[model samples]
Target chain A: MAEINLTINTQLAREILTGFIQSEITRVGFSRAVVGLSGGIDSALSCVLAAQALGPENVLAVRMPYKASSRDSLDHAQLLIDQLGVQSKTIEVTDMVEPLIQLDPDMSKVRKGNLMARARMIVLYDQSEAFKGLVVGTSNKTEILLGYSTMFGDSASAINPIGDLYKTQVRQLSRALNIPAPIVDKPPSADLWAGQTDEDELGFTYEEADKLLYLLVDQRYMPQEAIEAGFDERFVNTVVARVRRFQFKRMLPPIAKISNRTIGYDFLYLRDWGT
Target chain B: MRLQLALAQINTKLGDVQANLDKHLGLIDKAKKQKTDLLVFPELSLTGYVLQDLVSYVAHRPTEEDPVFKPLLAASHDLDLVVGFVDEDSRHRFFIASAYLSGGKVLHVHHKVYLPTYGLFDEGRFFAWGDSVKAFDTRFGRMGMLICEDFWHASPPYLLWLDGADIMLFSSASPGRGLGDNEKLESARWVERINMAYASMFTSFVAHANRVGYEDGLHFWGGTTVFDPNGEELAHGPYNEEALTYAELDLNQLRRTRARLPLLRDERTGLVRSELDRILSRG
Candidate 1:
């Protein structure tokens, strides 16, 4: 009750994020960033921020499309690329993934989507090497908490700028940054299959999810607290369960502690790894 | 007299003295515009907490003769200020110290008495421990100053109370910690409660200023606040945000509470001294 509303100053957030990106990149001896732009608000915001931090000349926005992907996805991504004047590339993943799909022959849609997601990461890491840039993440906190992202796929990146912003806050910052109205207003989708939208698959709107997530995660509310706060009992249970279940995705691979100095247990930092 | 006090809870970059000094000046000006009598900042506000080995780089003598603190001296000409900094004494030894300044001169300096070395704090590694706690006369009556960890001990506040100090200012850089069943930061909650308890027990006004923002993964929760003599909050800043919260302290409330409770009227120092002597002799 003592804490105030979960509102952030957009101007301050922008400055801090841009500075974080610049510092993290230069710290690891990198000067540029490569972002996988999906024409979604999250990716668009990341691309714009990276362009602002490292300059448009140093940002490379890659758009990886599937066979059934929407043409609007590409067009919307192009809108950002053109507006920002950053480098861009469109890579078709149908050929790369077709062999894996053929090997399974009757692969489910879920498997096929996961394949496409990881395929995009492959191209991203490859571009990171070719362009001498680090892969910047675009996963918002909502998707991350809900386990809505593909692991080792869209989630794999050297650093993430918008990972802490909730889906609603991401939209809020997108508006503040003047991202194209079409991209911001469009229904969220992963473009894995025809007519595939995020909320439709998740069975809830982002506004509903973000509010619930803010209370559950950022505020560290228990289920009863959320229930008292007017969140639906079933919805809170489901989201909280999903967050617990997907907690593994948020952490690195756990190592078995056998030695006095295991990698992650006691000997954690780089300096601890004996020079 | 009603004293207008402003607690400037700000985010400071580690070891960035020049930038941090500018931040202090900016907040000082803002407080002056509001006609505040006293402005207090967080512990080591001129050099952010978690300096590690950078303490040497940022440590500077806080005197008008020192160029680093010249601007702050000028800014304190109108408003009385309590600013924390790394103090290098005549012997060139560094101590975590807070200066009480008014009319462009450093009035009194309170070196941090308790150097917290456990857990995340390693102040003993860098700062020399202060040996005493004292109160001094200010325009707003006698007041005492304590650094972050000094509040955790009962002796400091008790000594100040015995010295007849009416107001106590505590500057802190406490990191945000675990959440209780109430779903709020337990550390911040405890800090507020203990501050109220101290204010009520000692029958004095209590004002605490804490820093906010992330530094090397440790996040300082800024819940800067002021409490009246009766343990009621006068002003509370939002948690984890940069703010300059203000409150008017009525010293008459302290007198009224003291008259009602009369706890400090009884003499107990002789008993305390005898018990301490006996305990130490057994050791």
Candidate 2:
């Protein structure tokens, strides 16, 4: 089995990401950023980077906890907020999301999880306007590639600092950035329901997925080539299928090409146009 | 001859010609104060890179009449200058070009020959490919200029070396990509290797100026550098930050290096020409 090396220069990654956060945010005329703190390593990393880029006073960390969210999640988030000395707010979304969840008592776990994720997005964006800041996203490359995030939910943001880093790389950077060990060491979860974990639900660990995806996506290996490289056939097939299925989530909404110069087609201009 | 060269590793505003021109003037003023004999700016220093639709609007012809070039040319009287901009032809075709200015006149302009179309770059769709690669005489000596992707290929620099250019000035708006195991980004490592190799192999001085800052999602790592004929690094700008790095080049070293290792004196131009002709004809 050919081992895929996922090790990165954490110091270089830190500089690039922090510069990315600072430049991307300030270029759009905002000196502040609002990050949704999920108490996970991804959010913790993003929040720390935002604090580093724009000073801690300019970053507003919003904690949107559902009724069934774990107590450890809240405490971990508070621990980071205190450690980083950024402005903190805890917005309980029980009132906002419960009314919707009660309408269909038999809602699936996926749907309920999506509701909670989007509820957090809403709070962060609203605080962004009030705080005059941009919403910094926390979705890592693994979740983005696997389509694990809900569209316009946790995936919605003005800028994403850690989106390029995979889940394993996120862990590596979290430790490098001196994030609290409890946040970095905890089992990954969406906290959609009581006692729910991400790896168990996905049926494969992130360690396994990251190595295969790095080959398939980064190295541009074929499915057969990935299997030849010692990834399980079933695992390779499932990851490939998920990546293809979620292609729409990665792109902007398709615009119809009726005019001579359409927005994404002929009227091509960078987002940094006229900045 | 000895020359003090300055690499202006600056961050340019996107699509703002006036603002960028002001920055160039400010830096030129600072370089003049330092008595730099030659000041170099990065690719598209007047107009930022990633100018997809803004290319035509930001393009300028390197003439005294041009609003952007007027001051830049006037500043050349104190010291020689190398600035990058989108050059517009009479036929209205835009080319990524670098102009050498001295004594209040444009000395030479080298249009970028390679338009990178694949991956994150879309230069082919927006601009015309340059067809010529020639070296021109300067007060310091004969020199050649190449844009970002131009030096990536072996032929442009090779042609300049053959054309009696002792100094190679390279500029880029290169983005930082591929995080490696080292402190330097992958792009920086590869570029430095190429610059050093060109200096040693061609036995000429090599200077590179790259921009710093982000436009849209792309982050241009600064790390401007200069290498002597002996392949020793003379000066290096900061990685991912704006800096005006200076390197003093003793042009006498080129004569010394070439005399020690007469790579150019052992001529194989006829052999290379015949082989190239045969290969092309066979194809």
Candidate 3:
């Protein structure tokens, strides 16, 4: 782990994923892959890569629809199954999740959202146990950056193929892979609540917002420059505000810097421990 | 010749090569307007750092006629340009690098030797570590170039000094969050102290340029600065602005100071590398 000399790129990424699958399968003695297909581009691209890297017979796509999920989402889930020809099943969360919600109907939206995300993960893991497969991830770089997705829910995965692709890039890759163009272009959502869309909840479009983000956050433009660059002053302020506000989600839990090289402090890099 | 240098602290989008090129071009025009002698930019200024796989496209040493180097060539017909980029090498693995251009010819290209991979950085993933330590004879002086993290390591700078570098340039894309007001000030002091140590040791003018922007969720806290041979701050840019600052460097002052101090003349280069290598190996 000492000074690994180089870092992440596409070739290294592919090699790492391919090598990881090979090693994980041999080391853990698991041969199949299971994924929660949300009829979203992230999961679709994951299945395509997993089925190709692993085998189609070895990949299982689980369509876990909730009570509030759009009917078209379910139909699109079927479209992905037909397009990829991977083994899949319809696991309605109505029976499972509703019981917990009924038991705790007074839970806040944040708690409920976390519960739904973890619930989907539980379903994926159970299916993995039933099918003896690894749970492939559907989270992409865009969601990961904003900390928009649930931590243990959609955030946890055995391995993530699309986690590196931006949401727009995911759509691009989806089209190239011949995934349903509608699903690729469709507005993203977790379908955790009724009439929910990611943008509506995020309060900004990914394309426009990411461009502004690239300016304010990435370009180190002061709030003034971002506002001057034709970005909505209010939107720029809000996004920049949120980005600074949630820097914690991107970092490890805060630790007391008691030691010379403390975790989350000076020992941020593995080089501290490496030769 | 005393050259006016503009450290164009640019914001580059990952994978948008043409757009990044245009941005660099715009900044070049800005530098051109300033009538700068050298338009220096941050490391990987053309393409934002923390890219996933696009470096593979830049992995090959495209012929000198490649379209990528066109803008810097045209940016100023006569002004010297020092820009940082991902240059493809023979192995098809890119290198973290700085290219100096003037008179329509790339004068010198310095590839980074230390590829940092731990923590949030993954420089080791895309770049092949460069082994050569060279001091290119520029029109200004015998200048040595280092990429980000190179100055942090001792080997390259010691080698550069031994190779007779009269001036050194380090380019960086350092990410910092706005959360740390206390820690930020402390780290800036640390950088200043470290660079001061380098300046004092080498007794040469040191120029450090860091990008000011965010990319892939990482923010570059640019406090680009220069120092005289006596560890004296010559000029420092604002912490978070895309700015250009110049310092009057009297090479004769450094020469007289070094001669009076007799530090460089008495350097013991013979035993340094071997001893350091032994210590590194033991660790």
Candidate 4:
């Protein structure tokens, strides 16, 4: 039962994240950001940070709700938009995903959910061009580690402000940033269907997942060591398996080495190369 | 005698040598206006820190004939300067190096001895390791220069102290990482603590100049600081921003502090040399 201290100084985190968003975006000659505000804590925290980095007017918070999305989601998103005074746009993604979803009658709910998530990505990228802003990501570390996110769907973005934060830390930062109570306090969900909560689907609370993942990932604990530290052996194995299985989603597609200077193999340069 | 020192905490453009050189010239001009006796910039200030493949493209020789050093040498006619750059040897091997220019002459050049190879650092892959650690004479007295990771180990600064360096100039492109309940970043707190410890242990002035900016994803926190021989912080730059922080070091304090502490006088170099020789021979 070795407890991991995942607590961060909210003020310091806020400064670093805001500075990160601003520097990453502007260094590439972008003055604005487009964030998919899902009315969840992760996206809300990201949107707040983007608005703080690039001014409120510079942040374009897009709400792309599917037909099955709860009214609370839309309302909570609107609450943040109004509070931050940032520009907002609503694009209903029902028409976009429904046609493809109807193509295969036996399409699993998981497939349907991924389609919806990706449909939002298309809309956000399109708006990024029209609005002259980069796409800001909202995927938190807890879900990212557990392979809970759809690759290139909710995960694709030009810059991510909170990708390193755990879901619990996201909630902590949201509260510190004075995010609306309903958004911060509500159960986490992807809202791909009528009633879908993230924890209920994942079979574990974010607090439990975050604590375990912190030990296994950040602290670099072995699975056997984690089990000895009071985490259930089955839980440790399951989490480790998920992390291992989803490793591909965390990185760029590997390129085969052919030449003496192969991109990503031997020809290495930072993304800020020559800037 | 007092030394007017300026820590030019700046954000360098990655791989753009000309742009960064222009920045250095501008900072030198400003430091001259302030009557600063010496100005120190962060490690790789002339070329950004995260240069993976761009290392050779931006490497320069610190000579009067070198294009990059020509203007910097001309600027040094007014005020002394400590600038970091990628130094290319005659054999074309590159190094993470810093040069001390005074009176229109390159006084000393220190290639970073310890190229941090693991955990977010790839200096070993790109640059050749520097072999020597020697202090040189300046108008202010004897001074030593160490790049980012060089001062992290105890030996570099210890060697500088033994070589009669009364002032230690440390430059870093130190990225900010690890946050805790403390207000300061984990990297920042540790660096400041070590700098102060070095100053107190060696009874010498220690000035650290760390850059600020985000390159790729790494953020270089800029809390450049100066500590007197008594380990008291004299000046501190703002965190995560660019600024030219200044501190007036009363060089006489080195003599006064050493008079009371007497650690330098009591140092046993012969005993340490014999012990190190014995340990090496056993291996």
Question: In model 2, which runs have C-alpha deviations exceeding 4 angstroms?
Answer: none
Docking class of 3: incorrect
Give candidate 4 regions above 4 Å deviation: none
RMSD each, Å: 8.6, 0.9, 17.8, 0.9
TM-score of each: 0.61, 0.99, 0.53, 0.99
What is candidate 2's lDDT per residue for B1-283, written digit by digit as tens?
A: 8999999999998999899999999999999999999999999999999998999999999999999999999999999999989999999999999999999999999999999999889999999999999999999999999999999999999999999999999999999988857788889999999999999999999999999998877899999999999999999999999999999999999989988999989969999999999999996
Point out the worst 10-residue segment of candidate 1 chain A by lDDT: A266-275
Best by lDDT: 4
Q: Rank the candidates by lDDT, best first.
A: 4, 2, 1, 3
Best by DockQ: 4
Ranked by DockQ, the better of candidates 1 and 4 is: 4
Ordering by DockQ = 4, 2, 1, 3
Q: Chain A TM-scores, all candidates?
A: 0.95, 0.98, 0.78, 0.98
lDDT of 4: 0.94
Between candidates 1 and 2, the TM-score winner: 2
Question: Clashing residue pairs, candidate 4?
Answer: A1-A229
For model 1, the superposed segments whose C-alpha errors exceed 4 Å read A1-7, A268-275, B1-283
